[model samples]
Target: MALLQLVLVLCAWWRPSAPAALPAHAINGTSPAASATVSDSRVRQERSVLTNYGGSVGLSPYFADLQGRPSPTPPTLTTELTPPPPKCMDEETCNPLARYRTISGRCNNLQSPHHGTPGQAMHTLLPQRYDSPAVFRMRAVGGGLLPNPRHVSLLMSLAPEGAKVEGNSLFVQMGQFIDHDFSITTTVREMTPGGKSVEVDCTACSSWYNPACAPIPVPLNDPYQPPHLPTGERRCLPMTRSVGYLVKDSQGRPVLSQPNFNTAFLDVSPVYGSNRCTAEDLRLHRDGMLESDENHLLTKRPADDFPLCFTEAGYCLHSGDKRVNENVGLTSIPHWSDERLYQEARRINIAQFQNFVYGEYVPLLLGYHTAAKMQLMPNHEGYFLGYDPTIDPGVYNEFSTAAFRMGHSQVPKYITFMNDKYEVTYHIPLHYAFFNNTMLALGNVFDPLVRGLLGVSMRPTDLKLVDSLGNKLFMEKGDPHSGRDLFALNVARGRDHGLAPYVEYLKMCGVKEEVSSFADLESLMRPESLALLARAYEDVRDIDLFSGGLAEVPLPGSLIGDRFWFESPAAGFTHAQLQSIRRVTLASVICGVLDQRNPRIPVHALQTPHPQSNPERRCSELLTVDLELWRETPHSPSPPCTHQGQSYQEGALVPVSPCLACVCQPGGKMRCQCDLSGCKQTQAAEDCYCRRICGYSTPHLKPQYRQ
Candidate 1:
């Protein structure tokens, strides 16, 4: 019943509506005079509505109800409800001419400023499957308690050794780096009488009373964990629920949704920081450069400033993303003096980062074929005209919680360090590297670590996790059991987020098999993996998303399965700008950072150094982004062209009609070409108006057509 109610609410929220046409002034980069029909206040209000609530104008009535106001009267088929736009939307503003993204990640999509902003709720691919409307999914399909996450982790994730993949450890490192760039779930905390927030300690009790506490209960006789105490108490790994907001379902019951602290785009938020304050803190405030030590490494923070730092140097390395301090290789990020230079530098860096992700990183991770299939690959030339503002580009819950977690399986037991000659110098166990920056701060270890990453092969994507992660994750120096099971935490986190079961995601990804029994998953999963899952889960339908997804057979030439592969939005770049950005490669970025002479690395940095396919290449051979393309040109006013009743600037795509391709030309001219392939030709050509707007096709329209 709860699921049904949640689905109904989501259905109402997601109901499709025709997006309003962009204002002529906004589209043509012209003065308000060009669109005199729309008042400035009205335009601002409309933009505010779109930005705050997404492109779905159908949500106005719901918003009214959500604000504790009387629900607006239902609209008839011919009319729509016109609720007063929220006051917050009226106050929210954007500068359409700004070239750089805001530090808060707002205004990237002009029509929807807050679409991918930090602290916004994550997009849900499917309706959440909570045990209750606002509770974690703790019950199995048979109305019994679900299997303990620790038990599942022990049965499925333990491996003596991990198999190596064709890619180097740098691939796994890059994945982790990119993962931090977008999604960071902030956990809930409690406040004291003085209003200071404190961490909710779930470890102090076997049964937690705090709603935020959802710690993993260590099962009895666990291989690595001690047995239950003489007082009949069990150990629990400390955990807290992610910070979330409660909204009303169709039945007026509360539904919890978690927010993502990072922006959804691949804008390198980890390097630049997610918000204005943090970005400013990391900046040197001169010449557009960030703070760094004399050696050009990240600036160190006072030991007392960082909660996780345990280094003897009485300080920890500071970064835009705090997680970078977890390991030595993880630290990876410029300038001009004027404010213009800072913005310009940020613009180019973001462009180059996007280019490498789409051009090299994604293709290698998803396999070139699959990447191309999903349209994730950038065009070698010409403008990418696939920008759609209506699409909510927020990170999906499934992707953040389950699919992207596949990298945890690829983590090697140790982080190896090698000399310039590629000779193994030393190694640090993965457990010891956590929260300890001693290895990074110790004399000249960064270069050796980079070499090791480039030289060592990463573990293949499989169900088995390395012993360090499966047994002693985040384990301190001497206490063998003073650690948590990462694999189990991953399982529990999914439930905390109320993610759907593995089978649901499989169906969503278009898997053909009807999975009623364990045997049905044989074609997709290994026999041993299936058996392990069978032993851990009560039913096939009850399998956690993270567990089942990791067990699936990897797609050909890809490290992950089909369900884990997802498409990212295209970078909205002009023809010349995009072409220049595409020149950037991961090798080039690495070369720019490495303080070495003639650093030789694989042309395809994400793959192993194959003699032929991915041959070793000097730093000079790698293609770097040409920042000259980003140089600011003085604004020169151009004449606007009028088409029908709208105005457009030269070279602008005119919104004449969907089936018609129209562009404004120089000298106040309008050029339109019609493609009626999907339209039925009637005796009266003028009466048959076939509409295809933003990929949505409408068969026939009357002569009185309006875009």
Candidate 2:
């Protein structure tokens, strides 16, 4: 019965339980007294009405009926959590000097070629792996006039096949495609002028992995281009790495390893496999003249295959012979002239790039802390950007020494080097070897030595020159020759596709003013005059004096001819005095007026300052009018290379100065005949004074001030 009742209750609750239950009660005839049953039924009907208004028929309302009650305050949110960053392999570390202590675990010195995450490599360049990285110590070596410590890099080259090495001399092997194969021969300790190493030794033996190897050289001869391969094909030279010892006695002659003073090598090269002979049908690669020992550039030579160890001032054995010194007139190459101990021996540091496209070529000399050291430092690594046929190869090698953050992607670094010669380019993968750890290299030297005395910071806009009183000495239309001439932001140069919005804003704010002629502009825009205007505005609250509001104050003109030259109708004096001021003041003008209609047509005064000959005296300024921009034929490429493109327009800033100061007249009072009158005597007499007699020239007496 309980089960049946429960089931009936459940069914009633499904659809308006109160009405269903009431009907069941009535059917059962157990309806409380009829009036009580009617009251109960009314209650059930009220509940049904309440349920419809409060919620859907059978649902419960979340809130109570207290509409006037105060609402609870919303909970406050506080802390926010950030996700952790990803981890990089230990070998791919940055700045090994300071941060190396924190890193743990064995690291592979063989860096990945792709410059990606360490250990998880995209590809490997070498096949064989070494057990431990080679260690070399550098100490300050001494040389003639050489001073300051240097972190120097070294490289070597391969002599062509059939090249003979006899008694410390290497003879070139002549043939086709026999170019030099350069590689980092060894690294030495920082050497200072007059600093001698007391002792030097090498320890911790190791063997080179993958033992670098290459194919033999092929003959150069294209049947289509003439000049067949001469001397036939030559086999690729064999190479080896080992540790060797050499001792020298007091007589400077080679001796077997003796106890007193001797040199031991960490790694040395022994003769490897027999040379490979070339075939008659061998094809030759062009000799590019790219490899060199002085610059640390490699040409297909394996890394560390041939290592050398030298005892301070002692001889090195088992190494390729050094070429004769051409500049110093010495038959021997550069060698350390000292007697001392070295912590470690020297090893080669090799680097290469596949699919290398070259553009600008710059011979880079290592930046040293001191001038003395700069003198001793050898030039290493000619960095440049790679460009082939199209562009002029602007940007060179990009190197970023920035620390590698966990999440941020690697940034492309930039190396800009320019001189008169051509440019070249190369790229560095962000691997352990080439992580742009220059900051770490910089840290090796003292901070005081590394930080430049000159500090430079650049903004999009040029700096505004202000005086001690916070007065702007230079304005948009101010003179460029004045000491107050601040470098203004050049807006036209910032039209490239990658510029930021703020740069455009600056360019807009610094617009060039329109002018009729350069002469008119310069008279009003001279640096000194602008400086005075800036000072006047700064000293006084109103800047109207400089804002074209106040009338120009007339400065006393120098005495000339019959009377003092004064501005007639001074209102237009500035416009008239543009280049004509030479007749009034002995001082020459320096500003110019640029013709707006035709930018190529420039009109200005030429005033060259002679500091040495004319100590205090100055001559009259000259008027200069430009007709057109000059042009020259672009530089022609060398023989066999045709001119690639037409010449581009280039602009130049040329200054023209006055030739003479004074003009002479016959039977007339002294007159200042400037270019204004075109130096025409007849016209000059009209504008300039010609000894006017005022009451007989007032007895021809000099003024009191002049007397």
Candidate 3:
């Protein structure tokens, strides 16, 4: 009887809906009194109306699509596939596709045109009936990649319009810049030379379909297909490149940078070699720029310069996908509101992108000491991560889906299009900022800051909280919001990809603490968020990846939480690749592209037209990459090492992979520790653990502190 009473008392205290006192260490770091103040503000922020509008976890009734597909089929328990055979891959009995007698997940891979084919011309995407979400989630049921999906509609709410954002709007624009490079989906779209498009049916793609899809695939439906390609061949992957031919830098060495793209970091084509169709398409795809005037420098395609569709139906606008499209407009078009001004604005924005990336974002993301150590500066052999013959960069799903999506929280509500006086000429809400083509047509406002031409300057987004738009994106004229919910889909997608839950990733990423229960999340999330999480899911282990990640507070000195620093080479992204990406900032790209021209832009100041922080200094001062270093060649023009061709000098401070140390041994030959350790479990485990602990990057990263 006494034990039962004790159990009842514990249960009372564990009531998730009832507010409980926060743990003593919940608000770590600050002094006790100060912590209390922070806690109150957080609680107030949690209870704000912004948290009320959108549903969390599962789809809200109002969030139903125009077609009546609701999110999440309740907090339903999942059914696991049959037990694996001794070797499922080899055994016909346990083969995932065996039951349905289908093999390739061809039709199953293409979901609805929810987000649509983002970077393509208007009228892109497969037929709704044939390649809908219903078909793909059928592929969802039987696979090792499948993890149980959790409905998290209870976590969302509308954001307060125009809250105090973190950085200026320029940073928000930068997110768009990188987003354009990385957000390409796995689904393909095929178009004919006559601009006719067809949805490729799966009759030829594979013999099996666990989802039991019909054979309705179309010919020439390749999204990445090259123009006039022979039939039966699949399109190559899209790469990040601007001009087909390489432009010479100051030293006559070739530097690859696209004129339309602000940052060349996102290689769209020939540079990466896989995205050939996108490259061919960017070369106007025969949809040549309306006129090939000087503004058409490297690219003359109408769809080349920032493709954002602005029509109501979002059908045949000059661009496609209105929200991200119009958002691109705030910066690319407004300031240079005339077609004639397009080239000049493009020049300045490109320069600014270069300046800001190298000078600020890189350092802000990877500590300055880290970038400097990597020797990321531009030079001939050292330029563009050096001409590596063996650098094949693959997109890691985790980086693509989760860590990179951090930009969504950075978008602000209303952007201030600056007038001649550097004051607001007008304010436009995010949803309404569609393609005002008249505003984008080049004859009107030329100067970015002119009265007729508005230079839209944006403030930063809330760092702690993700905007609801991040999860539930915009759609044209719908009540319950007919389009896709990025965050919700992200959670489900993460599960579909067979990703580990929130806590498991933390341990793998080497987070300092253990996460046994939801309460232990106090180190990361707010008490209110934790309580809400507890109410939404029966088990703490059931919390979805994004849900748990969304609840985390930004780590000190960083905008991202600990969950974002996932370092899994199995995902196909090398640690070296992460280091390489961190090194090529905006400044590096600008420096690589222009050679000697000063950007006339601010240093690390993303909020453009808002007064340069150091107006007196020239762009030269902001540049860390040196072009002259690349003037001389190495033993070979092509790098033998498989990396981004980073230039290194003694004491230049490059990242050291402790697990792959090349110590000199017997006859002047150097060997890596990993190679010497062989495949022994104990030694391999040590090397893996050491590499995982190689903490130059990440918020909760463990310090290797190796010189």
Candidate 4:
């Protein structure tokens, strides 16, 4: 009973504990100090507790045990939230090839004439189509080489335009795939067989230009240097021959300096021979020129294939080949239904001009009489033949029709005429290849047609590949290097419908099999590259500024995986390779692709202004005025530039000195103060005197006194 009573007492006491109390005085607020004392006491107590037990980890065993007890429910584990991967960089969101397809779509969206808008009407154009299945099986082909249905139709219109397609017995369609609309009008005052010269107007001639193309004046000023004499007198003198060709220097004057006549250095050589012309055959091909008389020369016959002979001097009478039809007999080819006077005239003129300029002087000066000898085929087409007797089998300087489309000015009649005929050649593919070669041979610069064909987002030097997944396939190296092999590599992968036709062309050229794999594709395409490389001018090899202007297409970095950013050989960039790439355009690109598909295809440049019977005599006559002028007045020495305090003698560059007119002594500041009167002087007066010794006081010696 007592224990029970005690337990009850303990329970009642444990029910609640009394709160810590302040002093009675502090509670009653008797004295402010007393209240402060109570507060201080509390503060001391808290400080002691904190100081005695460093931190939670350093707490006493009792506190540790109290906190260490496990919770009824286990603690839940937590994880970090992460973000999703970035969207594919390329629009197509797949690979480089996929990206290219997307880019192509976007390019089409850019809306240009070449791209053609949706619903745009296309004419029914079905030109002749030729194919060679032996060389190509038609797998992995791209649209680069083959013309789209639209393009194919356009090529067919050449038939009505009076053009002929012929080669290796292949009935190919005639017409340029991408020629400028041009017109060439030649009014030749010809000496008729009746001993009377008649002026004939040949306006219906076909050329790279539109029939409406108007003649523009050609600035006759020398492209290399200013005329030694006054402009008028310069025009009067005969053209200056290449210095190396001359036995004596400029007539009476001693050769100031012999020019580097090393054609080897210039990289000019016959296509069939050595630079030295060592072999008799090579010598013949080197000296002689390719002169076509009758369209029969177009025959694939071995005899007609034989190159004509020529002399060291520019002449057409060198080779006595009997099969020559134009000069000998005006016979037509078996297929040609009509001997169109226009076509005949054009062929004659081209052949004649080639014969005329074979070894003749390439006038160094512009507008000189000898300048007439320079029948620069305005466009790349036809050949330059030497007619001289000693050298047989003349050199054939072939060019591309694309060349004819470039450069605007008064194209010489001879060039204009040759351009017309070459353009009409049915062997467009092969002719084009030759034309491209010829331009390089002529040291002519290639001007690409720029129309933002590629988007502005990409540069011309941008490396691009077709990502199979629709992502831009960029190169690993990036920038300029991208253009390096991208052209060749992509060309290797890309295909077009026209590829089969191209293969057929190769078969015609004696190629056994069509390009099969990328390796074979590269091998087939290598010739064109080699051709371009062969023609590469060492002088212009520094492709700095020229390459910077080419159009580039951005590609994905990698072909596989989600990362579009590529770092590969395709991405490599360099200024030199880019310069070469810049020379590429849709037309050139198309041509290259076509060449890969069909090796040795020809694309012809038009030959305008038909050659006459005696191109040599006429060319010589053209130089009469200039030659007489040179005889009248030789080049005089340049006058010396005289100026005060500076001596600029003849043949020396003009001197340019900074204004050092201010006079300073010792550590004095170099101040330039002009006279107010002189500041208002005319420019001429200032140039004559003010900028020289006119202004500034001489430094006066400081007075020194001995101590």
Question: What clash count goes with each model?
Answer: 0, 42, 54, 120
Against the hidden reference, what TM-scores do the models get?
A: 0.74, 0.12, 0.44, 0.15
Q: Locate the minimum summed-lDDT window of 10 residues in model 2.
A: 148-157
Query: What digit string (tens of lDDT, one per residue) describes model 1 on residues 67-107?
Result: 12232222221111111111112124776544456766677
Q: For candidate 2, lDDT tens digit of each residue in 25-129?
A: 322244322110112233233212311212122110111111222222111211111111213324344331221111111111112111211112111111111
Query: Between which residue pairs do clashes occur in model 1?
Result: none
Question: What is the TM-score ranking, best to worst?
Answer: 1, 3, 4, 2
Q: Which one is best on TM-score?
A: 1
Predicted candidate 3 versus true structure: per-residue lDDT over 316-337, tens digit per residue: 2121111111112223322233
For model 3, what is the alpha-carbon lDDT of residue 330?
Answer: 24
C-alpha lDDT of candidate 4 relative to the true structure:
0.19
Better of 2 and 3 by lDDT: 3
Cα-based lDDT at residue 700, candidate 4 = 30
Best by lDDT: 1
Model 4, span 549-571: residue lDDT tens: 11111122210000110111111
Please report how far candidate 4 places residue 43 from its true position, in Å: 72
